[model samples]
Target: MTNLQDRYGRRFEYLRLSITDVCNFKCQYCLPDGYLGDKHQHFLSVDELRRVMHAFAALGTSKIRLTGGEPSVRKEFEQLIEIAANTPGISTVATTTNGYRLAANAHKWRQLGLSQINVSLDSLDPELFRRITGNGRHQKVLDGIEAALDAEYRKVKINVVLMKDLNHQQLPAFLEYVRQRPVDIRFIELMQTGLGKDYFDAHHISGESIKQQLVALGWQVQPRGPQDGPALMLRHPDYAGGIGLIMPYSKDFCASCNRLRVSALGKLHLCLFTECGVELRDLLGNDQHQEMLQQRLLAQLQQKDATHQLHQGLTGVTQHLASIGG
Candidate 1:
């Protein structure tokens, strides 16, 4: 049997892996302008990623999400998806993308059993989009969304991050877009991370506020299956797809947090709000280090906090959000 239960009793069923640390867009919330990493190194070869996936698969992980600075930019990302898809017991293979390069590769990704695509689209206005993601390819992103929708990607969720004074006004318009488009529109509250510290301030928007707005618009908010990370999903009276709220600030969800994050350079993060991480890439290189590191991985999984302490009181952040592949 897969070693699915951890030290804390949290199931090790879901794994999120960052395929690369690079990105094409300079999203303002991700990295600041003139950001430089002259000597930064990336993590995990396609083979290494496969090994990690296989190891985790032995632990009962069947759902895996491939993330990145922008995963599509990773060389031959489709190959990585294929490898993960073919992994034993990995039933769900998904990605969180900015949707810029998705159009050109949607068909290939779908053919490889990619089940979900979460696109981050902050604003409908191109100027605002450019302001939000420094690279400014809103049209391309939208086109990618269309292509994915056409390709029948199992579930396409649009991530609309609402920050006050930025794109709050577009909430109604975005909801309208989702209503007619058949995509599950998930509104995410701005998170406090490296970008929250180095690039921008925390944009306050709560799930209660969002629910109130939806109520005013003649919609009802009904909570669906409790999510593992931050998103709490709800549905309208007659809407086919549901609306999800990702509350990293308002609610500290550690008890039901069944996810683990693998950074681009192979650091294992048990919590999004933690300062500590296990450097797996470095450990994997030394053949002499494998046994000890393997034991440590299991120990840390047992120590994984059910929720994060971020909600404790806006503690200052140090890790760059870009580093986490948010």
Candidate 2:
């Protein structure tokens, strides 16, 4: 089997597959206006996703992350997780969600073989969370975390998108919440997407600021696993939980990129901010195209740019994060 290596020699072992673009929450950074696209649009079928997973596994990919506007919103989410968990050569099957359904379904999903989970929890304050996500079920999300822990998940990850004058000042609260929990709180720097130029300018804050705070507070950096996402993991002896900072604007941020993304419609995205994606749905129509599908994926990796052009104020075709399950 061939490895999915790009021109820059970065081996791709992780795939972020979006099951659907339809999200329930109207997060300020992503779909603040809410998902306006057709909710019934044709996303990849379960069989198509199976074929995609097999093709990637054949190419040395061992981790598959199912993402979406919210993956749990899909009717066949459980089936998708089961398929990924049972797929040969796939050792890890993870999913990122808004946690709306996690409180009730965490145990069932865990039993279905989900190995990892990341839930978006931007604010600890219920009202603040409601304002940021346009959802008032903040307590339900917290319960979801507990349910995941009870389900025997080794570690749960909380994704926090830091916004200036928004949830940025609540760092103390977040640190306190994780003091006794085993979850890893990931603070993501607000990114400049295609449609959020003004909002980005108003709210964007550097993750470096958070890192400095962590370092001064006696937190030490931790080594990352081979398939870990782009985050600088750190640990504190006094705290049971960990902290991670995802600073995409930092120097050489893309140098260690080990993952690729596939949109819900089966378009392969080499970079999150790429100008466009290459369609692969036609090749996914049947298992007979497995060889051809792998060839197309390998060919496209050669064309991936060494890095994204976000610093140059270009977001490409990504009008918003939800469009590709950011």
Candidate 3:
């Protein structure tokens, strides 16, 4: 099988595909103003997604991660998961969601062939969660996480976008929450999108600080898998769960990049912070274009920048995370 490799020798075996751009939550870092875009915008259909999945899988992509403003918001989400799971050469069908419907649908989704799940839970405190997400369903999300674990998913992860005065000080609480539960809690550094420049400036904290704390607390750094995302995994003997630090601003952060993103509208994004996207919808129109689609995808790898220009305060065309499923 031909692997999707870039000029820098980075081979991508994982794909982050956004099924929809519509989200219900108004997270402070993402859609702080709530979803304002066209709710009826045409996202990729199941057939198109199937072709996309097949093409990538044939190219040695073993994992496909469904992402979105909130991926579970799509009505055809279950079907999408099933399709990804059943695709040839694809061993993992994962998704990242806000846990809105997880409590009620986790088990069903697992049965439908979803292998891994990552829920975005910014804070543990109910009030803080409400404040961060601009919603009052904190308890519901917590219950959803429990449901995901109960469903016996292959792996369960929690995503926490760390902010200085928001939930950065709650590291101890997060650690304790994972002390007994077999979940991986990921602490992501707040990134600067085009629209959240002011907010990012006020809240962005270095993931290094948290890494130092974890080391001091006796957490040992673990090796990353071939297809793992940009998270520095750490584990402790005392805890059943693990800790992951996703520091996009860290030095050599892009050196281990192993994933590529595709927007709901079918645009290939070499980097999350890319200035522009290569339109792939035309090629996805029919199965006849599979060869051309794969060729286009392979050709675009030569154009991928070694690293994103986020360190230069340039967010490129990404105004918000929800736009392309952060």
TM-score of 3: 0.98
lDDT of 3 by residue, 46-117 (tens): 999999999899889999999998998888999999999999999889999899899999999999999999
**lDDT per residue (tens digit) for residues 52-138 in model 1:** 787677667788899977788777688888998999989889999989788898887899889889999989999999888886688
Q: In model 3, what lDDT does residue 237 have?
A: 100
Model 1 vs. true fold: TM: 0.90
Task: Give TM-scores for every candidate, taking all chains together and pairing residue i with residue i.
Answer: 0.90, 0.98, 0.98
Ranking by TM-score: 3, 2, 1
Residue range 1-326, candidate 2, lDDT tens digits? 33999888888999999999999999999999898998567999999999999999999999899999889889999999999999999988999999999999999999898988999999999999999999999999999999998997756899999999999999999999899999999999999998899999999999999999989999999887766667999999999999999999999899889889999999999999999999999999899999999999999999999989989999999999888978
| Selected candidate, larger TM-score, 1 vs 3 | 3
Name every residue pair that clashes in candidate 2: none
Candidate 2, TM-score vs. the true structure? 0.98
Off by over 4 Å in 3: none
